[model samples]
Target: YSSGPPPLLALRLFCGAGDSENLLLGGARARVSRRPKAMASAHPSQGLPSGMDPSMVDEYASQSKLLQEFVKIPSIGKAWVFTSKDENASRAMVSVSQSDLLANKKRSFLLNTHISKSSSKSVSFQWSPFPVEMSGVSAVVPSPSGKKLLLVRNAEDDDSPTKLEIWGPCQLENEIHVARSVHGSLYADGWFEGISWNQEETLIAYVAEEPPQPKPEFNDSGYKKEGSSQKDFRSWKGQGDIEDSWGETYSNKRIPALFVANISSGEVRALKGIPRSLSAGQVIWAPSSSYSLVFVAWSDDNGFQETPRKLGIKYCYNRPCALYAAADPFKEEADKPSTDSNKGDTAALVKLTADLSSAFFPRFSPDGKYLVFISAKSAVDSGAHNATNSMHKIDWPTDGKLEGSLSVSDVVPTVMSPQDGCFPGMYCSGLLRFPWLSDGRTMILSSAWGSKEVILSINVAR
Candidate 1:
């Protein structure tokens, strides 16, 4: 439930930067003057008056009166927005999937919109002439600089190879073909999908099914040892040992691994030393530093035993996971000792969130002042598949030194249930890998306000 101090209180009662007025919503323009006393006199509850239409106001009045009176942004499906750290340009890449029952076919289209910063306090969006057809795309990711986009086409058949395409704004830059033996199909499901582009935009980090294990060979006479490579029709192969994956969502397959690919050279490197008992996913490139990879590793409950058993991870936030920072396999050698290891080990994996039970969706601020993340501790503790979440931030050291005892400041606390006419609670399906506005302190995210998913803007600085 949206809780505490009202979700949109900051916008309705507080004033943002600048003295000039601008249109905050579509088809409506509310003048926000510097004169606060006069503005407050009009609405006792809201210091800022609504600039939206009455129909929109009535639609949202029950959920949040203050939000209805302030701003109205349409609900979006799958979307990606990127803004340069210099704050010079911003763009949004949005997609919507549609299926036709009569035709029995499904398709998706991508719309590109340019976010214009009219002023410090004003913003607007202008859509392109037409949307580009994304016919066979399994996943779409934009680079940090917004100069390049990565599109993945997963293999529909077991014999076909997976395809990766790198595209610029107007042209296809490069393509890479990955065989099934190198790595199985890439995970596009939200929970297991882990794709990221490095700061320099030279490499990409992602998660995919690990290489298949070698099977035994057979001969016409009987079971053949490793030395025989003759085809036999009489002998049948035995079943191999089964590997366990997370219960609900990952039952069909197992073994999610971390990999890095050099876009320019077309070379892929598999990260080693990560124990087989722990499945890795949701990886991202850290800020400019020696330890460039940060990912979430989920350990099996029976890690000590030979047959490692995985705990349920799908939609269940209760499973314990910590953010791990490690050296990039491609940039650094495997034998090199990790310089930032607090745990006495030659392996490059360094645990960052040792104190938290569950942590995911890591985002470094534009200025790299802090690392912000979301925690589902309540869901884990209560044994619920999904529950309210809390937002937290760790003050990043300017000198690029990080310790285990870094103090974590709470940005948004968990709210179970709220009173009537208030925010229900935070329903963050998942935070965008990079969910930040032009200002470092302000962030825009989507969450379930009641039955409808709504967008929320929160200022961690405040």
Candidate 2:
């Protein structure tokens, strides 16, 4: 393995998947399809797994169609590309969804490698010798240490429970099962996915649907409360009043809540005091010394309007959100005096971004000197679901003394539209939590720089 500092790396771009079965790869065109049907499913998860089928690899090896097909899927749906914080391994994991609606199930392929190549003309991927197929995976995230991977299998059957599996390089290390009473389906979509691992690697924070509210049980006599006995066949139940979850994408779902899981003991603790009026997502661990959690909270706050309305947040950044930090629940319990029967309330939750109208992805520098994030204020102000973005940074307090006084500074100003040939403005849906290089100053972010989503290297130190 190369012992030098990792170079400024970039991603390989591919032509969009099309109706034809032939794929143009590295200047060589390969007709790998047998039918007139579309080469691959539009969604990445539904697309063929990375790497040509081993049987076909021998015959089509001449074409070297490594990532030509792998990179072409239209919607990567919660894709994750991450590298380890420690230098022990110089590789990274790229997880792509292959969700199949017909099967009503989701799966993913894990390709491990270091993306150190950038080409101006062609797409390339030094894919791991082969991809590991993870079946029925709802979400996947890599730990900061890169030594562990978290794979989530959401309950597909209403009665089934959610399963969280922690895997090391060789085999499964631990597993945790969360009951439906504790939470419902996880928020795996890009906008609501908040899964994160703390610096210590022992705890994981994520966003999931809160436990559903109980429906009213009706008997032959009348409607009954919780204390009432079970209904018999003679008693038919009436439909309960429907609860709307902020409209649009969240139909029949409850509000999203923040939860922390202890990997070793398989315990989950919900952070208390998050108002039901607000929804939380895109959570990341703060510098362990400063705070336990940092997440974006969207509130139902309206100013001067006749009726208060909840903005549709799915794929929409225009909904106003600000970063907030809170202490880990377990830590708070430990700090309390053991003898004190009355435990104090959860640590005070602090709002870190009072000035930013839309700030989400939170990435702390490798050295922990700065907290960098991307803003979609332009989209928020323009009322568009998607638009150009801005990058900003905050000088983190050395003593971990955080307050609302933290000021946001621009690193990359908003670019509405890009001029010819130059890089198009930022269009990142979200960023990898530890998207930093070894230098601690430069970060690698993927944005819709142009017709294609391009990887960019930004030097915040400048």
Q: Which runs of model 2 end up more than 4 angstroms from their true locations?
A: 1-89, 96-107, 112-130, 220-223, 228-241, 246-248, 302-307, 338-347, 415-425, 449-453
Clashing pairs in 1: 1-424, 1-425, 2-423, 2-424, 2-425, 318-380
Root mean square deviation (Cα) for candidate 2: 14.4
lDDT of 1 by residue, 98-215 (tens): 5544566666778888887856758788999987778888998888777999999988877988788998878988888888888877888898789999888999999998877766
Pairs that collide, model 2 = 45-97, 45-98, 45-99, 46-98
TM-score, candidate 1, is 0.72
Backbone clashes under 3 angstroms, per model: 6, 4
Residue 260 displacement (Å), model 1 = 0.9
TM-score for all models, in order of appearance = 0.72, 0.71
Best-fitting candidate, scored by lDDT? 1
